[model samples]
Target: MAFESFSEFLAMGTHGPYVWSVYGITGVFLVGMVLQTLSAKKKQLKRLHSILVKDVSEREK
Candidate 1:
């Protein structure tokens, strides 16, 4: 399945659209997952910080 030229490689023998679209969609999905994971971790850390502060304040009183 060797392409004789760059044009043929890009065309992917008429299956270019499907192959390129799949790659694009997969890239977007991976980026979205990474962002979601980062957001969740930030939220969890904020909540933990608040809880720790409250515990310390309670002990002082």
Candidate 2:
């Protein structure tokens, strides 16, 4: 498809909003998933560290 002018290209034949919104939502969802995974990993590591310390202390006594 070829546009006669720049404006026509941006309008995208009146489907611009729907097409752009899909892309935007996809990007946001990907970013959110990454952040959530990182925080969960941090929480898991902290919990594991405390559990290991407790086990070592019990064995000493």
Candidate 3:
């Protein structure tokens, strides 16, 4: 309602670049953080599994 058209809405009355850039940066960081968390979790699980396997094998001896 504030903007007359789609292009005008995107322009955001001369603040488009700054506003859109901030949004883009935030989205990138959010995605990066999610991916990093998943990767770290996978690595941690693998490490724990290895430690448990080693412990069990030692117990068998």
Best-performing candidate as measured by lDDT: 3
Clashing pairs in 3: none
RMSD (CA, Å), candidate 3 to true, equals 2.1
Taking every candidate in turn, the Cα RMSD to the unseen true structure, in Å, is: 2.6, 3.4, 2.1
TM-scores of the candidates in the order shown:
0.64, 0.59, 0.70
Ordered list by TM-score, greatest first:
3, 1, 2
* TM-score of candidate 3 versus the correct structure, residues matched by position: 0.70
Error of 2 at 41 (Å): 0.8
Identify the runs in model 3 with alpha carbons over 4 angstroms from their true place.
51-61
Candidate 1 residue lDDT tens string, 15-48: 9999989999999999999999999999999999
Instruction: State residue 31's C-alpha deviation in candidate 3, in Å.
Output: 1.1
Error of 1 at 19 (Å): 0.5
Q: Give the TM-score of candidate 1.
A: 0.64
Which model, 1 or 2, shows the larger lDDT? 1
